[model samples]
Target: MSLSSSVEFPARFSYACFRLTPHSVYAINATILPQKCRLSTILTAPSFDELFPDALVNPSRPSDLHSDPFWAPTLSVDLSDASGIWIHLGKAPAAQCDKLLINVYKEYSNDSSRVSFLETLEVKCPETAVKWENQRAGKYLLTAYVPIRGCKFLCDSADKHCRQCLRTHLSLEIRENRASFIWLALHTMKDHSYEIFIISAVLVGLIMLVMCMGMVYALWKQRRDAKRVQEIQLTMYVKAMLIYADDCVEHRNCMRMLVECLRHCATCEPVFDMEKLLQPDSVIPSRWLIDQIATLPKFIIVISECGSRILDTTESRTHHLVQARPFADLFGPAMEMIIRDATHNLIASKRKYCIVRLPYSPEVPANLAVLNFPVFNLPDQFGQLTAFLHDFENIDQLNISQPLSQSRMTSFREAVRLQMTFFEQNPDWLDTRWRPIDEPAIPQIREQRLPVEISTDEDRIAAAKLYGIDPPRADSEDEETGVGPSNERQFMLHPPANEPDSDTDDDDLSTSEDEIDDEDEEGGEMHTVVFRPDNLF
Candidate 1:
């Protein structure tokens, strides 16, 4: 009885039986291989001269199996020492095939060159699988059968027969069934080392592909996060404050132009929004300026004639804008406190402020004399401003370029009083004259009740009455509606000619009709003016 066993293996691992065991064989074959399979055999062990003497009966080893005429006429099967028969099949045949057979014989005796078979099992090609007991460590004779036309061709199973098994040529033809037969007797085993090497190469390739893909994704994510962080940094805004005078038309126009120019500075616009302060209808407060100065990076002040006058002037001050020289001096001690309170830290000049002065008026002082403060003029290339803005970080406590001059300083309350007086007299000038109607209204200057000892002119005195100040009633100035100081002689105060008598009433009529007539001839009105010695003295 003959047994035949044909098992499918991976094409890449063709003769690599040990490297790719039965477990890995199915996984690679089912997923990667095609329907067609290519097969090559390897033989090893005892030499064929001692095993099959029929093929070389004339004492000559045949190099080619097809050298025989009977092996021709059909497929030419090469029986080599290193490589045996090669087969290509489109699809596997059924498990049971009468034409293909395999015979397995277990060797029982330990012999030097000859042995006898004990147990035998006949396997029908691939259909009926033969299970041999003690297959772990044993010697066996296994022969494979293939169909050749209507005949059977026999070949030894590689690596199955060992030293204990007898090397013998067995040709079996049952019931004279042979039409034509080609038999490879006692085929030796062959170890195809190159096939095992090919399987290892494929596994390494798959691992490298997965690692490359992971590296690519990681690099892409790193770049994406870096780009997002850069964008956030570019668009962030830096705190800033703007200072300017709006006392005259040219000053206002220059400041408006500057504010618009700053708005057009695209890079700096993200860092500062000075445009809001210059908005026509914006009513910015005096404290708002201080607040911003206490908390922002850049402070821009337009140096002009109006600014110079206020800084120089000590006696009279504007209604809304306090003299900076005096205000700074008045709050010199509180400056550090105010700055510390606003920022919650000690003052850091570089981080807290970067002052820029624009000379709107050519008459600006040769030196603003502010220490550590730099003035930037309007450059021919406006783009430089945007570049300059990047130097300063956001902070509180910004000082304008112009420093407080050494002069007679007033208290904050006194400065406020002076501002109130000017605004009271010229309220419209503060609110309506400079800016457009649609713009934000200017902050109303808060009115302060000043001591009457500081007497204003008669016009201011009359304006004061509207603000609840009680003034002495006029006597002769009434009844005549349009009577005012004539162009002939200016109104003058004259001292009394004679001291009043102690017996006379204080309200007695002192002026005679003859003196009034003489004064009428002289083209001067006779007037009795009572002066307050408390104010004049």
Candidate 2:
């Protein structure tokens, strides 16, 4: 029987068969073969030399039908030694192909050559069936078959062999497919990473926004609190100014009080709005002097002994006294009318111009004037002054009306009486008593002597040194000696004293005196007179 013959074997039976060649051996099991055997002698088995002309056959090999053949079959295949095969499926086939049944084998030459059944799979050429002719020595084999009606193939007793299994059998065939799946997984991871980054950025922005809002709120609250404090301070400042104005008006010395108020107002560093108290058209006028005086309801005038002398002086007796008339002229007429009219009006109407006689001096006006109207010793004047400053403190309360329960007038009278008795007993007090205002205006008489003309150079030098001037040296003395410079000569000028003796030459004085006599001399009285003790007593 030839190796290519078909053999049939009975079911479940075991058999053994043998064949022999010049340099080969083959063993067969009859029971394992097909039941019918077809022995077609039309083709003869080729000699090992005929099958492979280049092969070197061993001559000492056995030649027996039962003995091992020169060619052997290896049942196992080593994929590690096998060359890989590749297959391509274009797009998708229009129709499925017939079932591909293949018998695979692994062959190994004694020379360590590797051959695989998978290599004969026709991976490059599709739609073809694969078959094996015979077994060879040093060869491994496997069988692969595609089952009809299934999406997979069967191989090596495995029921399912899909494209994934094809890769295990032939790694080269599915290289691109494996790489495609790897790239897809990487793309998915990239997308997930980007999403995570965006979410993190949004979260950070939200946190920053919350922080900024908190800061803004804090600043706004701080500003609101500061504004509230400023408003309270301003209100307090206004109230303080009002109180100071009232206090200033209550004191009878309105001008001095006004000056104090102005000083206090200037001391306030951050100036407050005192426009209401100082406005030109307001109840309190703008001028510092006018405001204090006009705001006081009433005031008293105190005249001292010195004031009386200034009013009583005559130009004829003491020429120096003539200088005082200008001062008297400034205030005299106004004082007389105010005192006379206001006193008369008050006495006739029985109105409260409560006059308490205090010692008076001529220089000081005995009457107080407001808008050219007099207010003379009015008891209600004290009451009015107190009412003006009821809201203020630190004022001269003595000048204002005392409470009815406390008699300020009686106390004042008793104190005056005591002082008068003391002055009567001690005459020295009268000498030191308040002098007339004219005393201040008296021209101090300096002793006069005829000035010696400094015609000599020595006199000029001495005069220069005495007056803190550069001395005329001997060199310049010759140019100007008799006529000295006007400034230097001033040190030598002195008015003549008693050269025209007035007591000895009365006629000489009368002629000059009548021409220059003061206006008061016509009436034989001074318009403003200082009442001496003789006139008063």
User: Best candidate per lDDT, number?
Assistant: 1
lDDT of 2 by residue, 8-46 (tens): 542232433323242221222232246564221111123
List residue ranges in candidate 2 displaced over 4 A.
Answer: 1-300, 303-326, 329-332, 340-537
TM-score of each: 0.24, 0.18
Per-residue lDDT over 1-537 for candidate 1, one digit per residue giving the tens place of the 0 to 100 score? 111234453255445453322111122222225746432232222233322234534446565755221111111111111222221111122112343333444444465244454544443434334333322123444444333333324335563432222221222112112121222111111234466568777878888888889899888976666455322232654434445554543334444454545554323442222344345665444454465555666555445434444343341233234322212221222233333443553244433433344422444443333334344554232333444355533212222221112231122223334444555666575334333324544455655565444444464345334432223333433324545443211122333553333333324322432465478789986554443322331
TM-score: which candidate is best?
A: 1
RMSD of each predicted structure: 23.3, 34.0
